[model samples]
Target: MIEIFTDGASSGNPGPGGYGVILKAGKYYKELAEGFRKTTNNRMELLAVIKGLEALKKPGNEVTIYSDSKYVVDAVEKKWVFGWLNKGFAGKKNSDLWLRFLQVYKLHQVKFVWVKGHAGHPENERCDQLAVKAGQDRQRHQIDTVFEQEANKL
Candidate 1:
């Protein structure tokens, strides 16, 4: 089985944001992280999971994801994403990310486990640290084009 721990952070609700991911399979491990110049915490949260899944080298693996975001955990655990997909993601925020998630999601048997953030969970805390550092590193942050475009539309 593969275990993944993920976290996201933002300086402001819709400000600079980033995600951190830790993937482990037996003794093999990998970390993924990136920052977005303008994005939401929820977007970063969901993106962390997506990035983790995308990093998997094999298909049809048994995977479990640990996250602190109820927004992301509940959406997948409660099966809301399927409904959203059925309706073509109408009235949804982050449709781009959600769609990207679905594409990578189908390649594995995935489960989500929710944990309390900042509760001293070692891996989760490390992920949170990575996320915050990435978010605050302005020089390395990349544009969140979809978010920027949506803001421009308003």
Candidate 2:
């Protein structure tokens, strides 16, 4: 089984954002993080999970993801994302990421466990630190083109 711990942070609602992810399986471990020039926290939250899953070298592994974002955990645990997909994702945000998520998601057996943020969970706290640090590093931040393009239309 693989365990993933994830966190996301943004300075503003749509400001610089970043996601942190830690993947652990047996005696192996890995950490991932990246910053976006402009993006929402929810995007980062979902992206963390996506990035984690994408890191798996082989499919069909059982994955348990720990996250603080209700927006992500609830949507999957409650089957909201399936409904959204069936309805063509109308009126839904982050459809791009969601679609990408579902693709990688189908390749694995996935579960989500929600944890309270800043509650001293070791892995969660470390991910938060990585996310916050990445978000603060303006120089290395990459453009979230999909998000920026969609935001421009609003």
Candidate 3:
């Protein structure tokens, strides 16, 4: 099984935000993270999972995602996102991220396990640290265009 741990951070609710993802597959491990100029915490949360799944090399691989976002995990497990889709994501906050998540979610046998934020899970703790660090990183933030565009429209 390919196991992943993910977390997201925002300086403020809609301030600069970022995500961290750690992937463990047997003896191989990788970490991914990036900062966004302007985005919500939930967007970072969902984007972390979407980007992690997109990083997979092959379809049909078993994937287990551990995340700190009930917003992300419950939406899938409780089938709320599908309902949102049927409603055209009406009154939704993160439709773009939801669609992006569904696109990658269907490519694999995926399972989501919700972990409490700031808990003692090693990978989850590390992801939180990484996400915090990412939010503070002052490097180029051009990768936030999609998020910025949406923020502008709001």
Candidate 4:
């Protein structure tokens, strides 16, 4: 089983946003993060998980994800996402991300565990650092079209 810790940070709502992910399989580990010029916290949060799953090299892998975002954890763990999908995601934000997520989500055996941010968890702490660092490193980071694309629908 692979253990993944994920976090997303935004300097401001609709401001610079980024996600940090740390993956560990045995002694080998990898960290991934990137910043978007403008995005929301929830978007970054969900995106972090999506990107983390996308990074996996194989299907049928058992992966446990640690995340601080209730938006993500509850949607999956509490099964609200299925209900939302049944309703065609009406009145929902980030349907794009959610749809994108489901595509990759189905390929793995995945579970989500909620963790409190700023707590003492090791991988969570590292992900926080990486997220903040990437958010701060937005000098040359490209604008994420998803935010603009979705915002246009409103």
Candidate 5:
């Protein structure tokens, strides 16, 4: 089984956000992180899971994801995303990422485990560090075009 640990951070809500992901299977391990010029903590949180799932090269793998975000864990585990999808994601945030997540998500046998953040869990703490550092690195930050455009429409 593959295990993924993820975390996200933002300097401010909808400001300088980033996500971190750690993927492990047996002895193989990988880390991924990226910063966005502007975004929300929830966006970063969901995106971290998306990124980790997208990293898998093969389909139908047994995967378990560990995240601190109830926003993500509950949505999936409680089957809320399915309801949102059926309703065309109206009045929902992060529909774009949610759609993208569903695409990759269907290819795997996936499960989620909620972990407490900043409680001294090793992998979770590392992910937090990666996310924070990435968010702070202004030079390498990428534009979150969808989020920016949506915000502008408000």
Candidate 6:
């Protein structure tokens, strides 16, 4: 079984943002994080989960994900994402990321647990710190092309 703790933070809405992910399996542990020059909190949150799942080396593992993002948790837990997938993600905000999520998601048995942000959960707090620091670290930032293109459309 594997446990994943994730968090995403933004310096401002649609501003500098990043995601932090902690993946643990038995005695092995890994931390993953990356920053984007422009993105929303929700996008970062979703990307955190995506990146974590993408890192899995093998399929069929039992994975438990802990996150504070209602946008990501509720959509998956409530079965809303399935409906969106069926309809080709019509009218969806982050269809690209959602599609990416479903691709990796199907490879494992996954569960999501929603936890309160800034609460004292050790791993969660660590993820939050990683996310915030990454967001503010200009040298580590990369362009979020999907977000940038969407913003151009508006």
TM-score per prediction, in order, is: 0.98, 0.99, 0.95, 0.95, 0.99, 0.98
Please provide the root mean square deviation of candidate 5 (C-alpha atoms, Å).
0.5
- Compose the digit string of candidate 5's lDDT tens values, residues 1-154: 9999999999999799899999999999999999999999999999999999999999999999999999999999999999999999999999999999999999999999999999999999999999999999999999999999999999
State each model's CA lDDT, in order: 0.95, 0.96, 0.89, 0.90, 0.97, 0.95
Model 2 agreement with the true structure over 1-154: per-residue lDDT tens digits: 9999999999899999899999999999999999999999999999999999999999899999999999999999999999999999999999999999999999999999999999999999999999999998999999999999999998
RMSD of every candidate to native, in Å, equals 0.7, 0.6, 1.2, 1.2, 0.5, 0.7
Which residue pairs show backbone clashes in model 5?
Answer: none
Note the residue pairs that clash in candidate 6.
none
The window of 10 residues in a row where model 5 has the poorest summed lDDT is 8-17
Tens-digit lDDT string for candidate 1 (7-124): 9999999999899999998999888889989999999999999999999888999999999999999999999999999999999999999999999999999999999999999999
lDDT of 4 by residue, 28-131 (tens): 79999998888888988998999999999899999999999999999999989989999999988888999999999999999999999988998898888888
TM-score of 1: 0.98
Summarize candidate 3's per-residue lDDT along 1-154 as a digit string, tens digits.
Answer: 9998999999998888889999999999999988877777998899889989999999998999999899999999999999999999999988888998888899999999999988698999998888878888868553667767777887
Q: Candidate 5: lDDT of 77?
A: 99
Q: Write the per-residue lDDT of candidate 6 for residues 2-106, one digit (tens) a residue.
A: 999999999889899999999999999999999999999999999999999999999998999999999999999999999999998999999999999999999
Residue 132 displacement (Å), model 1: 0.3
Q: Candidate 6, overall lDDT?
A: 0.95
Clashes of each: 0, 0, 0, 0, 0, 0
